[model samples]
Target: MYAQVNATNSNSYIERYKAILLQHPEFTPFSWGSNTIYIDTEYTLYDVDKNGIPELIVKEDRSKYYIYSFNGTDVISSDVCYWSYDECLYEYEGNGIAIHDGGMGNMRIENVSLYSMVNNKLVWSGELMSTEECSSFDELYSFLDSLTPINDFLPITDYSHLSN
Candidate 1:
């Protein structure tokens, strides 16, 4: 009943999201090269569900992403990702849809799937296409190209210090 008791409006969720980010264990300054993701304000948030309240996307570690959303009763999180030695990428489509595509190398576990936040729960809404499903990169790219291209995402930024 977190959302029921606490959910008032979209802005409230954003504020709550900020508070959770501050207390997040993996909510640290993260960057691999030129891209840096920060947890500061609304500019960096995404409304994957189109519920007016945007969800927080956190890249916790090497290959794990924690997506948080409000279920109209309380805030909840989707399962964190687990990438192999080579993998990292994600983007959102229109209507609260998200797609993640990554994986390469010998031990790599190729994966691509669509996700959506419904009723405060993050669920896989599309079929998962892995290396087993797609024979080669060409096949994978073709599949990806066929997907809806909302490509909604904010540029990665570094404002971690601002939260401090």
Candidate 2:
């Protein structure tokens, strides 16, 4: 996987993260007996608690997620979630078909959500497939934007509402 740090912050946490990534060549893709293993890396600065300074979340392969401070040095925590499923297909309006096995074509129909890291967990709560053609980043961005802010975790009035 490739890494990019914000150029504006020369001595920022992102820079350090990039430096570490560069030094540790293991972060890049490596071949193990002809089977290639990719190390997908991602970074984000978000205010999980609305504390102004953003907390960092680093994403890796196999739906693994790590939470780190913005300083980019210390790892706070990590969470892993499984990502695998199947969705049925059917015909629909405005849908196109592709020839599978060089035979009669089948149009993509049902959409199955895929998993990606959110906060520190691999969440499969977003739409993975859509009728429209778009990049995975576009879908991931839409999902990220749709996340609800964690305002109040512990409400004194009731605990039954925490059944989510």
Candidate 3:
């Protein structure tokens, strides 16, 4: 499920849809295609920028995804992609977090970006592929495997606790 800060209490507002979260004081009304969007609970929490804190990645729908990074008191949200199918694969390299969009089922690589905390915000520093270059999924996977990570952020050792 997706989560957001409750804005009033230390408790976080977690739910499957933005519309439901909107019921809480922390969220404001935002227009979208529907309020019935379901978020996959299987999320990943990793330090994308090696800043001693981890960012939360969750799938909002089949094509929409978000990455949230905490900065002391509040959470910063990053729109990872609107055309992504399934979940984004994250690799903790010596530099930063390498995110690959494509790998589920027959999905081909659509985009690859490296995210790191810049000025307290998660920003894309590099792009592996911006256009449709690979014709097959295997080719895309091979290309993704060959890419060199740009961010040299350290990896978080304990990530299991974040899921619980």
> Scored by CA lDDT, what does every candidate get?
0.56, 0.36, 0.50
Which candidate wins on TM-score? 1
TM-score winner between candidates 1 and 2 = 1
Whole-structure CA lDDT of model 3: 0.50
Better of 1 and 3 by TM-score: 1
Error of 3 at 59 (Å): 1.6
Report the candidate with higher TM-score, 2 versus 3: 3
Distance (Å) between predicted and true CA of 139, model 1?
A: 2.9
All models, RMSD in angstroms: 6.6, 16.5, 9.2
Model 1 pairs whose backbones collide:
3-73, 3-74, 4-73, 48-96
Clashes of 2: 0
Ranking by TM-score: 1, 3, 2
Q: How do all models score by TM-score?
A: 0.59, 0.31, 0.52
Q: For candidate 3, lDDT tens digit of each residue in 1-164? A: 33444333223322222222232232224346776533333344566777666666544434454566665555666655454544445565644666675444555336776666676455668876643665665676676677653222211222343433
